[model samples]
Target: MKTKKMGIQKHYYLMMLPGMLWLLLFSIVPMFGIIMAFQDYNPGQGILHSEWIGLENFRYLFQLDDSKQVIVNTLIISIGKIILNLIVPLIFALLLNEVRSLRYKKFVQTVVFVPHFLSWVIMATIVIGIFGYNGVVNTIAGWFGGQPRLFMADPSIFRELLIGTDVWKEFGYNAVIFLAALTSVNPNLYEAAAIDGANRWQSMWHITLPELTPTIVLLGVLALGNILNAGFDQVYNLYNPLVYSTGDILDTWIYRLGLQNLQFSLATAAGLLKSAVSFILITVSYVLAYKFADYRIF
Candidate 1:
């Protein structure tokens, strides 16, 4: 029996070998480049022979006006997405639960969930077409005797547009968790509430919301880890120089610094700072999740 169990475990370990090797090649190997954050990285000299500069790159990063603006943009966009992603998905799940027609519910879910699978590359093009000067939005405005406006180029509303579009794109997919949580809610509670003269609103508020509190808390706490990750792919594809003031985020800024401007050391320093902060946030979020929601990986 022991020999048979050992054989089975060995097969499992073999299966895991490919993934472990991939991680080492891509993720673990790249971590060695973190040394560049403290050095004046030179391509000819490479990471090893580069002049070590300690915290100078960090000091320069903090002094940059562009860096300040980028940080502000990242926080604003990320926080907006987090808050709306939480509230909108929960509301969507609650409303969906009230849907009695199974076919209609499934249809609506399919329509919304489809966008989540679509890459940001595709979605950015669709979004540009919709918000373009000659697009549907401006065309509608022209009907109301309003002048056509370039919605995509307007810096004032850029952040709001990013948040709104992200919420629309993801709310349906995010709602799946809440919907799953809703299933575990006892139908007896709803029946009892209805018998005591509770309306749909009353039942949802008093019974459903309470039942889903732990899930809501758990997801919200976990989301704190991503507070710095303002959608790089989406923003990178969509934003232009005109919208840079309001739309540029840390990832895009770092990309431009390293690849575009050839400030490799500065970019690495910025990336290191982001990684360090993200690590701390992730640790704190996990602690909070464990304490408040009784959530744990192990």
Candidate 2:
């Protein structure tokens, strides 16, 4: 029996070999470049021969005005997404759960979920068209004698746009977990609540919400790990100089710094900082998930 079990496990390990190699080539190998953060990296000289300047890049990174603004923008956008993604999905799942017609429920779920599968490349174009100076929104506003606002270019509302669109795109996918959690809820609880003269809202409030609490807490805690990841693909595709004040995130700033401005050291420092913070947050989030939600990877 032990020999048979070992043979089965060997096949599983063999299956994982390709993924492990991919990770090594892409993720693990590129991590060696993190040393550039502490060096005046010269492409011609290569990483090994680059001039070492310990902590200078980090000090300069902290002193920059753009760094502070980008950090603030990232936090605001990510936090907004996290909060809305949690609440909106939970509410949507609850509302969908109450629907009597199975056909309507499945159709609504399918319609909302389609956006999640679409890449940000496609979504950003659609968003830009909708919010452009002469797009559908402005065309509609023109009829009401209102000025055509440049929604995409406006700095004041740019963050809101990013957050709102992200929530809209992801809430349907996020709600799936909530819907699955709802199924595990004892139907007898609802039956009992109905016998006690409870309405739909009352039953949901008393029974459904309580049953789904663990899932909600688990997802919310897990989301803390991504607090710094403010959707690079979405921001990179949608943002411009006009909206930089509000829309620029760490990833976008790093791209401009390194690739555009040729400030490799500074960009690497910024990236390293983000990676370190993300690692810490991810560790903390997993610990919290284990404690609060009884989640365990092993």
Report how far off residue 176 is in candidate 1 (Å). Answer: 0.5
What residue runs in model 1 are displaced by over 4 Å at the alpha carbon? 1-15
Cα lDDT tens digits, model 1, 1-298, are: 9999999999999999999999999999999899999999999999989999999999999999999999999999999999999999999999999999999998988888999999999999889889988988888888999898988989999999999999989999999999999989999998999999999999999999999999998999999999999999989988999999999999999999999999999999999999999999999999999998888998
Whole-model lDDT, model 2: 0.95
* lDDT scores in order: 0.95, 0.95
The C-alpha local distance difference test score for the whole of candidate 1 amounts to 0.95
**Total clashes, candidate 1?**
0
Candidates in order: C-alpha RMSD to true structure: 1.8, 2.0
Candidate 2 to truth, TM: 0.94
